[model samples]
Target: MKKLLYFEQDSSRIRPIVVALSKHFEVSVAGDLLELAATLRQKEPRILLFGLASLPGAFSIHILDRIKQIMLNLHEEKLASRSALSVVVMHGDDSRWQQICEPYIAALREIPFCDIYVIPAATNPDELAVSIINIKRANRHLRTARMSATAEVPIIGNSTKMRHVIEQIRTYADKHHPVLIVGETGTGKELAARALHFWGKRSHHHFVALNCATIPETLFESEMFGTERGAYTDASTRMGAIEQADNGTLFLDEIGSLSLASQPRLLRVLETGEYRRLGDPHPHSAQFRLVSASCINPIDLAAKNKFRSDLVYRIADLVIEIPPLRHRAEDIPLLAAHFCSHFSKDAFSLEQNALDKLCAYHWPGNVRELRSVIARACANNSTGRIFADDIQFLYQWKFEGNSQPEVSA
Candidate 1:
C-alpha cells in the first residue's frame, strides 16, 4: 500500500476518514507541525494531506507557511524530491471558509505537486475516501506527464518525414502562436498536439482537450464557454474547456466539424482572450495556447465556404501535416514492435514473412489500424511468435498493386 502523511490538530474529527483510507493506504496522522515534520523525515511518504478545517480558527497562513517551509527543508536536505511528493489541501465547503482559503490555495498552486479538494460538510467517510484516492491518482498522472515531458520527445518514428514533424513540434512548442495539426483519419494528429503541449512552456499547466466532432451544435457554446448556475433549467455551474484550459493548452480536435455559426464566437475569444459564460452578462478573460486538429484541410473547407477563412487564418499560424502510414511504410517495423510488446504479456516476435505482409498492404486507417491489427495478431498467436498466417487483415486489398488478397478472420 502507498504511504500517506496527514496533518490535523483534531484527531477525532478525521478518525473516520483515516479509517476509510486505511484500506487503500498506510496512513499516518500528525497532530501538530512538529509531528508533521518528524513524520516526513521518518515515513518518507509520497502523499501529504493537510486538514485545514481542523486547524484552530479553521485557517491560518502561518500554518501553511510553516508546512511549505517544512517541505522546502525536506528538499534542501535531499530527503524528498519534488516529483516524489504530492500535497493535498482539504477543507470544508462552508462559503466563509472557502473564501478565506482561496488566496492561500492559490499561493499553494505554485507548488506544481499540490492540489486542493473541497469536501461537503455532510460528506460520508466513504465519499471522502474516494475523492482523496482520485486526487492521488491525478497527482500520479501529472508526475508521469512531467517526467515524460522532460525526457526525449514522446513521438515514435524514425522516418525522414517523422523527423521533420518532430523538429517542427520542438521548434514551435515554446511559441505562443496557434498551431493547426493536419492529418488523415487515425494519423495521430492528437499525438502531435500533445507533443507540442508537453514540450512547450505551458507544460506545468492543464492540457484540456475537446472534440468538436462529437459535441452537438447546440452545446458547443456551453462547452467552449462555461455556464453559470441556473443558466438554463437543471443547469449547474460548470467550467468549460476554455476556462479549464486557461494558462495551458486548449486542444480542439476535428476542428473542421465545428458549426459555422459558432465559428465567430471562438474567433472572438482567440482575438480578444475574453469570453462570457452562458446566461451571464460578465466577461471573463482566459489566456491559453490554441492547438487544433482536423482530418480535412481547413484551407479547402474555407474555399468551399464550409469554414470561415478568417478563422482558418487565425488557427493556422503554424501548421503541422502528419503523413499517413502508407507514406511512411519504413516505420512499420518499429511501430509494430512497439505495439507487439505493449499488447503481449510474455515475450513475442514477428516472423519476417509477417513483417513483409504488414509492410506490403496499404494502411488506409494509418497508425491506429496498425495498432489494432497488432493487438489482434497478438491475441491469435499461440506459440508466442506471430507468422503471416497468424496476422488477420480485416479488409481485402491489393498487395504491391497485385490482385486483392484473401481477408483473414
Candidate 2:
C-alpha cells in the first residue's frame, strides 16, 4: 500500500476520515511543521494531504514561507521528485476556512505536482475517503505516464511562455474535450499533441495522426472515413483514421488546409461520432478524442469564410497557443545546446559568441530551423567547439526587410 502523510493542527477532528483512508494507505498524521518535514524525509510518503480547515487561525505568511522553503529544499536535494511527491490541499466550504486558507492554497498551487480539492462541508467521511482514493489513483497514473513519456517527447524550454504552454498541456491532457493548437509553422504543434496523448488516460491506446494539408481534396473522404470493398477500382476493406484512433486520439495537423467541402463532413463526425465508409451504407461509431493543430488562426480563417465557424467552435473547446521562437528568445540557448548534443556523437560545446549570435538573430522558421542549422554546423566544424563564424543563418538577407548582418571571414 502507498503511504499517505496528513498534516493538521488538530488531528483528532479528522480521525474518522483518517480511519477510513487507513484501509487503503499507510496513513501518518503530523500536527506540526517539524513532524511533517521529518515524516516526509523518513517515510517518503507518496501523498501529502494537508487539512486546511483544521489549521489554526494564527497561521501566518511566515509559516507558509517556511513550508514553501521546506518543499523547495527537498525538491533541490532530490528528496522529493515532482512525480514522487503529490501534495493535495483539502478544505471545507466554510467561508472562514476559505478566507483563512486562500493564501496558503495559492502558495501550494505554485508548487509543482500539487493539487487542490475543495470539499463541501456536507460531504460525509466515506465520500471524502472515496474522493481521495480516486485522486490517489489519478496521481499514480499521471506519474507513471510522465516518467515513461519524458524521453519520447522532450519539451525543452524554461522560458515563461514555455512554462505556461507546459502547464496548459498538463491541465488539459486528461480531459475528453477536443483541443486546438494554434501557432506558426515549425512551432512543435505535433509535439504538444503527442504530449497530451502520452500523458493522458488514453496513453495505452493508439495515437493516430493525419496531416490535413497532405491529403488530396479528392481523397479526403476516403482517407478520413475509410473504404469498403469495391468502393473504388481495386479498393479493399480498410480502416480509416477515425477507426484507427478509436478509444485513443486523432491528431489532424494543419487543419486549416482542410478543403471547405470536407469541413462539413468532418464536423458531422465531431458532432456525432458517426462516419460511413465510401461503399458501405451503414454508419460506424468511433469514440476518440480530437486534437487539431493549425499554423493559421482558425478564427481568422472562419471570418474569411474559408473555414466553418461551427467546426472551429467544436474543435477549439480548449486552445493552446504556442509562442513563436522569436517571442521566447531566452530559450534559444537551451534549444541550441540540446540540438548540438543530439546531432553530434562526440562532445560539442557552444562558445559565448556562438550563443550570442544565436540569440541575436530572429528565427523565422522557429525551432525546426534552429535544429537544421545546428546539425550543419556540428557536421562542418573540425574542432569540437562551435563559434560565431561557424554559425550561419540561411535567411540572413530576409531579416528586418532584406537588410543583412555583417559576416566575418
Candidate 3:
C-alpha cells in the first residue's frame, strides 16, 4: 500500500480524506505545517494531499513562503531518484486561499508537483477520492508518453483535399498573422496547424499546442496565464503555456470547445497580448504568433450562443478551410504512395487497379482514414507490391456483415 500525507490546520477539514484515502493507502493526517514537514522528513509519502480550508485566518506571507520552501525541498529530496511521490494541492474557491498559496500553486503547475486540482468546498468525499484516482491515472499516461517518445496522434488524411492543406501550409509558412484552421472531427486540423508552425519562420522556437476542450475549466486561467509564488493554496511559481511559447508559436486546437465562462479571459489575452499571472498584479506580454483550429464552425456556434463571436472574429484573421478527403480524390494515390513509403520503407508499389479502387471510395474520415488503411496494409504485406487485398481490408467488415474487422496497424 502507498503512504499518503494530508496537511490541514483543521482536523475536521481532513476527516473525509483520511477516511477515504485510508481505504487504499496508509494515510497520515497532520495539523500544521511544521508537523507536516517533520513527518515528511521522517517518513516519505507516495502522495501528498493538501487541505486548503485549514489555513488559519492570520496566516502571513512569510508563513506561506516557508510552507512552499518546505514543499520544494521535500520534493527535491524525495525525487533524488525515480519515485512515485507526488504533491497535490486542493483548494476550495477563489478566496483568501488564492492570495495565500499563489506561489505553491504556481510551482505545482510547472514542476515537482504532479497536478493542482480545484474542487468545490461542498464536494463529497467519494467524489474527491474518485478525482484523485483519475489524476493519478492521467499522470501515469503522461509518464508513459514521455517514455515512449512516439505516440501517434489521431490526425490522418491523404486525398487531394489534404494536398490543398499542404499547399495552404506552404503558403502561410512565412506569414506573421494568426491563422484559423477549421475542420471536422478526426480531420487533422491540429496536424495541419503544426505543419504550418514547423515550416514557418518560428520553427526553431517552441510550438506549444493545447486542446482547449480537454482542460478543466477551473484551470484554464492558470494554465494559460501562469501563477506567482504563494498566490493560491497550492501555487508556488510556474510559467503558463503562453509564457512557455513566448518566442515561438501557440496553437490552440479545438478552440470551439472552451467553456463559455473561460472564453472572455482568452479573448482578453488575444486583444492586448498581455496577461497577468494568477495572483500577480503586473501583466506580462508573451510575444508569440497564434494558430487556432476548430472542428465546429464558430459562426454557427456564435449565432446559437454556443461560442463567443468576438473571439472568433479576432482569431479568424486568416481563415483556412481544410477540405475533407472525399472532395479531393485526385490526391488519394499520392498520399497512399507517401504512407506506403513512410510505414513500409520498402520498394512498395501499388497496382494501378488497386490504386484506382482506393480513389473511388468516398472517404468520410478524410486523409486520416486513408493513412490508417495504408499503414495497416504496409505493416501486413511482405511483398513489395500492394494489391487489392491491402486496400480492401478497411471495408472487409462491411462486406462480411460483421461488426468488427482485424486492424493491423
Instruction: Judging by lDDT against the true structure, name the best candidate.
Output: 1
TM-score of each: 0.67, 0.62, 0.58
- All candidates' lDDT scores? 0.79, 0.78, 0.70
Clashes of 3: 28
Q: What's the residue-level lDDT of 16 in candidate 1?
A: 87
TM-score of 3: 0.58
Q: Rank the candidates by TM-score, best first.
A: 1, 2, 3
Each candidate: RMSD? 7.6, 15.4, 10.4
Q: Which stretches in model 2 have alpha-carbon errors above 4 Å?
A: 1-152, 397-409
- Give the per-residue Cα lDDT of candidate 2 at 349: 97
lDDT by residue (tens digit), candidate 2, 42-120: 9888888767654443563445667777787787778876354656566544446545655765665456544434333
Separate clash counts for every candidate: 0, 0, 28
Model 2 deviation from the true structure expressed as Cα RMSD, one decimal place: 15.4
Candidate 1's C-alpha runs over 4 A off are 1-153, 397-409
Question: Which 10 consecutive residues of model 1 have the lowest summed lDDT?
Answer: 113-122
Q: Between candidates 1 and 3, name the one with more favorable lDDT.
A: 1
